[model samples]
Target: MRKFTEEVKPSRAVFVKWPLGHPFGEPFKVRQHNAVIRKAFEALKTIKKPGTIIDLPFRWRRDEDWEDKN
Candidate 1:
């Protein structure tokens, strides 16, 4: 779904740009998963203002580019 965090106007939020179902990254990519979780908690600790939205720096590989080599 489209990001609706703006409506909540949360005092702190972390927005990731990953695809719909795979917010952290493809299954089993531990490092990417860790980063997503890590930044979120960090945002929770650091954001001080209402409606603070932190967009993660991680980028997802395009659907066409993602490989199911596993």
Candidate 2:
């Protein structure tokens, strides 16, 4: 719903290219979830303008470990 989010123009947002209902990564993956949350918090702190949507740098279902490099 990235396009939808764009239209809504929330004060701040984080966009992840993962499937719907799995925004925080696959179920039960704590590290992946934490990484996504961390980035969101960073956005929350760093975004200076309203309606800013931060496109996170995580790939959906990547082969390597999710939090290893990030």
Candidate No. with top lDDT: 2
| Residue lDDT tens for model 2, 1-70 | 8999999999889988889999889988888888888888888789999999998778888826456735
lDDT of each: 0.70, 0.84
Tens-digit lDDT string for candidate 1 (1-70)? 3258778787888887777888778898766667677777888878988789997656676433223222
Question: Candidate 2, after superposition: displacement of residue 11 in Å?
Answer: 0.8
List CA RMSD, all candidates: 5.8, 1.8
Prediction 2 global C-alpha lDDT: 0.84
**Which regions of candidate 2 are displaced past 4 Å?**
63-65
Model 1, residue 12: displacement in angstroms?
1.5
- Model 1, TM vs. native: 0.73
- Candidate 2 TM-score over all chains jointly: 0.86
* Most accurate candidate by TM-score: 2
